[model samples]
Target: MTDAESPANGSGVGAVRSHLESTISGTLESRNAGAFVHAGSRHDPTVRYCRVALGRRWPRERGREVVAVAFDGDEWLTASSDDASGHPAETLAVRLAERSGSNTILTPAAVPHDAALYLERAGLDLASTDVVARARATKTTAERDRIADAQAAASAGIRRAASLLADAAIDDGRLAADGDPITPNRLRTTIDEAIVSAGAFPAGTTVVNPDPEHAPSTLDGEGTANDGDTSEVPLRPGEPIVLETAPRGPDGYHAGLVRTLVVDSDGGRERRAHVGATQSFRSAAAMLTADAESVTSVEADLEAEVRAFGFGEGDDVRTRAFGVGLEPCERPFEGGDRIDPGSVVRLESAVHVDDGSWLRIADLLVSSEDGERAAYLEAPSRSLEPSALLE
Candidate 1:
């Protein structure tokens, strides 16, 4: 890599959205969306593909999903409108499609009911497929670098957690620092502050409450750390501490990470779960190449690794992995979809050892086209030991 592209010397930040970065872009694939109108809010299932269809980023207001763009195979037509009475975006989209000599709207069946009425009233046929989502999942060079930057920021947060845990003391079978017991809330705050210090914004659910000593698992609502006082419990000694977070960079791209740690270990379930989790982590990551087949394959491999470690796939609560980018978990590779280069996916490997106790290790990975290797975006160590994490 050239010095100009080095992460330290040149931080490539702007790859997606800016300013009201909350205000994002509206886009739908025109390649296969021919003779169809593509319109939906960010809340739609297809809404996850809204920002990637066209090419670059545009502006989307916080609440209104009122932008529609259509390509008639020759020229481009763009229109946007807002109203309380009906779906103005859909109205404009259908009108533009008809103007382009087409009377059909190609959209996922998951589009909002109000928006669906616009196309149905126009007597246009609705195609029940998410062609826009299937069109492409590749990120440009700048976008990849931007995501890597966000991963770096997330790594900073993990480092902060590790540093704090390393400095804490085990007192009366509990983690303590500065004469006070180290709580999940304190660790989460430390991690979020580290992410912010590294020029990234912690999401509403940034740092999930880590697993304590006796009671291991505390994963809530896919990790809603900012929700209740679940993170107020003091950490236990010699148990798995799950430090998982997804933080967004200035460019509106997000990165995810999960690493477990055990303090003052007595070499019990913590060691066993960590060993299996680490192996599963590497095994799943190895399948993130451009030619990778499906997410199920990776998930199966991870499950096997943990199961081989003499653990059962804990009931309904288990581990999972998927694609990560603008949204924390977007464009999942389920349903036998092919992996494309330039796609960033997060493989979160969790091992449920017993009731209320689990161990997990996760990382952000970028696919490579050359078959050479996929690269990890975050640079934090996945050591289950605090001293190793300090390294």
Candidate 2:
């Protein structure tokens, strides 16, 4: 996290202030701007917000207020409860608005519905939108560092899983490690452990799909193979195992990694699909630039390449390019939003083979300033060579 006392020049807060100044003529109000504390515990977003807003962590010195307002005609005002009146945040905000003679305040879209109603009842006009999301989409140098740390942890987890797959003993068409059979549950646990040990938070559960037909179609779905009894099905040669994970570091930034590997061989179709997916990912990533064309145009080019490589329409092949930061899927690189320099995004491609299996790969890339090419954040080799996993 960046120092709170330091100026947030060109940071998300600055971006948000610029947006509000241009859009609204009144003051802006925010509440619960930090994380909710329960039993002496708080989440990372709250901590990060506090670091950004106050240059400090939570448990904010009780009477010291964290709520801030950027008044249109005046400078920014940051206040805490002045007295022991025990006033709620909304009440204080209402009082501030009335005192300042401002009728409406712009809030972020994440504000709860009840909060909105309360603000409305207090005679404060509220304009809510994804302002915070927009601010977060473009990361600061500190935020990028945290994300890179998280991505390193995610890569460690992936390498651990690959090592397990490569070293497992294949006996009677079953995979065994350390004299015990390797199940999806066990593998997921191992990956989580590796991630946590590598300085990341504990990943609740990872998607380990040894069966292509049973893999979740979307990236967000839960992983359940062999009817949720993944141990019942052992590893088989020539079968694709999809291992996908999104792990967050202690600082609360997430990095996503997805790789599909085969125990022995992937047959000809899987190899072709892998090649196509790789091509699609590289093509799309190459087009990501600060002043590049529209996302739709880049996507069209990627789809065309995939189709030309034999994974055409109705083959269930999909490609997505989006930002990755505090959240795995931050603001999408879509809707005509020009790619901003320093924006970290992921290019993902998943292709379903004729044998009812899936081949997928994803990589992280960051757009560069003028005259510079986009850089790869996580440069793990995408080679499908089985020997690479063993090494």
Candidate 3:
């Protein structure tokens, strides 16, 4: 690091701020203003927000990632891993224009906007921002690799959650194993401990009742139960248990796992539903093995399987499967997102019974080059029974 770039000590935030302030230099003011515009947080200081954003995107190598800073009263684009010093802003502008062609390009609208300068340097004109965003959405193999690892950790967490509930029964405000009730707050603490033992972060955990009348509600991913529903209620025989967990690595890659269990009962009706749902999950898994299949295609197949299993169309199965990455869920499998060769997704297929009987199982799915051999991190059995563990 140069004298101008030396980081401050004491706290991580301080060091980050120092580095950003120095690295950005004259561009800091403009970048800070842009940060506010993007964040839409009037109370948040622009400089602090810029520092945080940069910290999140900090590349391992100083010059490997692309970054734009206001420089010489203009926005300058540079890649620490590649073009560290960067060309004149006008040159980069031209390049951006050429890459976009008919698409529109966007630049920072805040303090030190110089997108026009970079565009001119690249011998191109500024276009629409949408086009540039589209191009950047595509993932690389390296990123997919990280995402796959994250999913593996997340799957491990789900297994741990299953173990925690193996003998758990909730009574009143407390959860019980045999007859003794455990407090509602203890549930998270216990589950979280188990998750750590299983080798994954306790990103989030929720064990809630599935409501038919209000079943159409969406999961915020934070695991909150809808309305006044009480997940803290006593666990009764024949009631369903939903456990969703996600774990992230230090690298920011993440994965998710969702498992639904019914207390100690695997009767014909319950077993049938579980079997059918598990089969549906497997079918989707099978389809994901192929690289040629897109996320939408996989979702369609999963839905079809659910329907074929005798479930009515009115029963909303909720989300099919989605991409898992840095944000717990990322690209490729997000709704409306396409699956590319380098994408990593999580496969979830579920069946809900009228009496709040639900069965959901999730696994990390990696797209394969063959379009027929997608990989999975969670190898739990498709049966949903204890005997089906790791099959």
Candidate 4:
């Protein structure tokens, strides 16, 4: 590398290291998110550490004594709130502003639905930018390590999820671990249990698409499948099963992976189709790394590949594979999207049919070399047939 490039890269790495240390130390006040604390533990000290980290990253435009507010907090009492009016809780921004003698406050884009109007009413100057969003999108070396572990955890979850389905398909209603009739509800129940065991939190979405009849967005959804039927659909001999697993690691990095499998019979046609689509996704991702193309370009490339693979053309294809770190789905994948070097992506090419089961084969990757190369969490299987379930 050139001397200039070396220093610049070094500085970026130093910045990430400094930020994480200070945040973990809890020397500063934070505004962007709930302070970093241990998982499932009640400790307010984490807040102080996060404040220091986030506060330091606060742009000078926010001015000294900058206050940052994370929309998702314990004090948030409502599932949804009017952002135009300040919520009832004592906001971090307000309190920090008063303490630091700063008049301006910044908020994450995920701020309440009416955040713009609400901040205006609070008598504080407010501005919105994806500064934090972009920063969080790219994964640092340390951050990527955490994400790698998280992705491994996700891979484990996917295997367990698929195993449960396979057991149900072959074992005449008998569960895999519990040895009971594997019902739809039971499949979800077992999956949740496995997620917890894997040391990750469960998202509301489903990574598995075993049947066309059951198209619930998330595996944990209690709502009936697309058909609105309660009848249980266990894994069958020739049915395609999509194993999609996304779980937040111990350090909060999201790792997402999807694999398509057929219980007893390898669906050759579906497997070949999935392989072709996955290759296209790999190509698009390669360009994303090489050219540092915006999310839009990546999305377009993926869509084009899907159409080439003989999937329906146009926007009808379900395609979005972008950054998923800190909070999953952190960036939108569309053409002309400016690139960030540290962003991690879960680029996916989903294959859905009209009233038939669809599948997704995806991998969580980190962008590097100024967006020229995408580093996978690990070597991902290019096809549905895993020599051994990926871990």
Candidate 5:
């Protein structure tokens, strides 16, 4: 490794702060923003882009990952939480934009007020153009690959969930493994282990809910509402268990996968709902495009597809698709933003059954440059039967 990228050098922020010469025209242009400023912790996309895209690294002691960063598409200035250089990370970050060729800085609303004041004090214009947000919504090929790798790990976690369900035996109507009633904590630990083994961090969250309709919502991929819900309720046979996991890859990209399975099913209402959810996934895959104008329209079609299968949609249970990447839900094109050609999305298809639960499946999806149709990054059976994952 080069000296700057090496962790042993203790170069701290200087290693990452480069004054590269680029064809930035050294003059303002009506094109993409010539300068961008962002501030967030390591999980933020700014750090990811700096680390992954720009091939930069922070010193080991200075690698706290939380930082205020500024860039002009080529040059970079950053200050981390570990900065002892007597310079405030936020102020240093905002000050660098003045040196950039651009007269204005494109920053999101999340900018720190103190740092923002630096721009104003320096007499530089501040444009709330969402430069970072826009770039994050549009994934480069490498970003998509990282997200897919994370999703593959996420899929492994879901597979582990299914394998556990398959191995559990019905003991007095409750799912049992090793003669102990399997609990949500056990399931979460197992799934998280599988995810880590597959080369991703389970930092996002792993949710194991026996009943999604009544369980706290996982619509945001955090499952924060159901922190310990249904922990005491032993999963019963014929009951549906929802496993939703969002794992971030080593490089800061993230992906989500959710699956619902039943142990020792009776082949009744649950089966129908499972089929409806699975079919909706297949149908949506057949229609998605890389440049879909309105993702909401595509989501509406999946809702209709689920309704056609004799399953009723519940107000609490939603069937939809949204962008996924640097965050579990990067949320692209939802607010009239154009769909990025290489963006990754999560397709969630769900149907509510009379059994007081909602059956659902979610997987990472992507469309090719051909713009014909989208497809799943990983293929696992959506069957309600636990053994389907093994198939």
Candidate 6:
């Protein structure tokens, strides 16, 4: 499961939680005397204010003692007031700040503008950009395991989709199973069901781009089959199909996978591009070692590898490498920030074909302790030979 999906046990917070505390403590120290006020729901994606404040999942009924213990004597405040007669959450937070002898309250940058204004008017100095995100970016060992589990589950979903494609029968220009032509919607439903059965949440929209050469403008709404009903199109042999899925495990961590495939067609050009993408992925993975200096350098190395394979970074080709954690695409790598050991990243390479078709491959890689090489979390073969899928 992803770290975001993983349930926090009753046990106190560990390394990641401690790092969050240290980050907030450091921020508080720099700003003089103040407490960090995290105002948000328990499920807020960006801040997860309650989790950070409590050092674990929020205990709904436990009163101030739990709060005091989690804070460890540090003056911290939370806007969890449900009492309508007393004060609104924001107003209560301001009052708590006043009583705690802290004149300032550090809030996350994701706070709504209205809430920020309220804090400002409460006679409390408000600082934006809390350390929660920074702490989240650098995951602990346990968090990495959760992410790995999520990635594994996502990979399982991809395998299930590939298996369906492999077993599908091509009749004329359409793909079918058991005498029924398969539609994109059917395929997506099957994929999502498989993902859920495999212990991961169904990714809302699994992109299924059939006939990549003449890809659809968008994947919104129910898919189309050949007849233009809800299922508007049918899978045609020889056409390159791009399948991308980002599934979240029960723990709330997300993992992504993208692969290009073809049925009975001659896959010479597509195979070449697939090989190029695989090679580029390897080259990028090599740069994720402990000694890697910066994300910019790694991206440059990846781009150079793609260029070496005769692919340009223009409209035809696309590449991405970023860290993955609570979110499918996490920070540092997303922001092109510095490289740190133990950061898990996903690297992708795609090359467009002359016919508007494209082949792409993506995999997860974790930085090594020495920062010289990365460990491949998912290293499936990238061969585009039809036999590979058929068998």
Compare the candidates by TM-score and give the number of the best one: 6
Model 6, span 1-391: residue lDDT tens? 3323335554424665666678778877776646665444445554352353345554444233211111212644444434334324456555655575677667677665655666667776767764667767666666677777777766666666677777789888788777877666666776677777778886574667633334431254334332233334676777777777778766566777777767776856676676667777777766665365466777667667767766655646677778776677766664357667767777777777756567777777777674356777753356564346324
TM-score per model over all chains = 0.78, 0.77, 0.60, 0.66, 0.82, 0.82
Candidate No. with top lDDT: 5
Between candidates 3 and 4, the lDDT winner: 4
User: Residue by residue across 1-391, what tens digits does model 2's lDDT show?
Assistant: 2211222334445443454343333223343121121010123242244345333333423433434333333343333334224333455455545565556565555554654565567766766545455556666666677778878887777788778877878878777778877666666777788887887764553677634355322222244332334344555666777777778765557787778877778368888888777787666666764365555665576667777777657777777677787667777566576557767777777777745477778777777766577777764556565457445
- Candidate 1: C-alpha RMSD after superposition: 6.9
Candidate 3's TM-score: 0.60
- Which candidate would rank higher by lDDT, 5 or 6? 5
**Residue-wise lDDT of candidate 5 within 1-391, one digit each (tens)?**
1111221122222222231113222322455455766666655564555554446544544444466666666656666666635334446644664466656776668766766776666666777755455555555555666778888888888888788888998888778888887877678888899988997889847877634344433333235444445554567777778888888876667788888887877788767667777778777766666346457766776777777777554433467667886667766747465454555777887666654577778887776565546768875677777787888
**Better TM-score candidate (4, 6):** 6
lDDT of 1 by residue, 170-285 (tens): 78888888898887778888889998889887875455434443232234423442243456667987667778888876656678888787777778776776777777767666
Error in Å for residue 199 of model 2:
0.4
lDDT of candidate 6 at residue 290, scale 0 to 100: 35
Q: For residues 1-391, could you state the per-residue lDDT of candidate 3 as single tens digits? A: 1111111123343443443344334332433322111111111123223423244333334432333432221332332214435533434444444444232333434423443554545543332222212222333454455455555555554455455556565565334765755332344455566545644455553333333332222232234433443434344545555556666544445556666665566475556666666666678656655445656778888777767766677875744666665455545554667665545677777666654456676766666664446666644454444333433
lDDT against the true structure, per candidate, is: 0.62, 0.60, 0.48, 0.52, 0.65, 0.62
For model 5, give the 10-residue run with minimal summed lDDT: 1-10
Residue ranges of candidate 5 with Cα displaced over 4 Å: 1-28, 31-34, 58-66, 79-102, 210-229, 312-317, 333-335
Cα lDDT of model 4 by residue, 245-309, tens digit = 67765444567777776555545556656765776767875776675667777767877777776
**Sliding window of 10 residues with minimal summed lDDT for model 2:** 32-41
Return the lDDT, model 2, position 306: 75
Q: List the pairs of residues colliding in candidate 1.
A: none
Q: Which of 4 and 5 is the better model by TM-score?
A: 5
Better of 2 and 6 by lDDT: 6
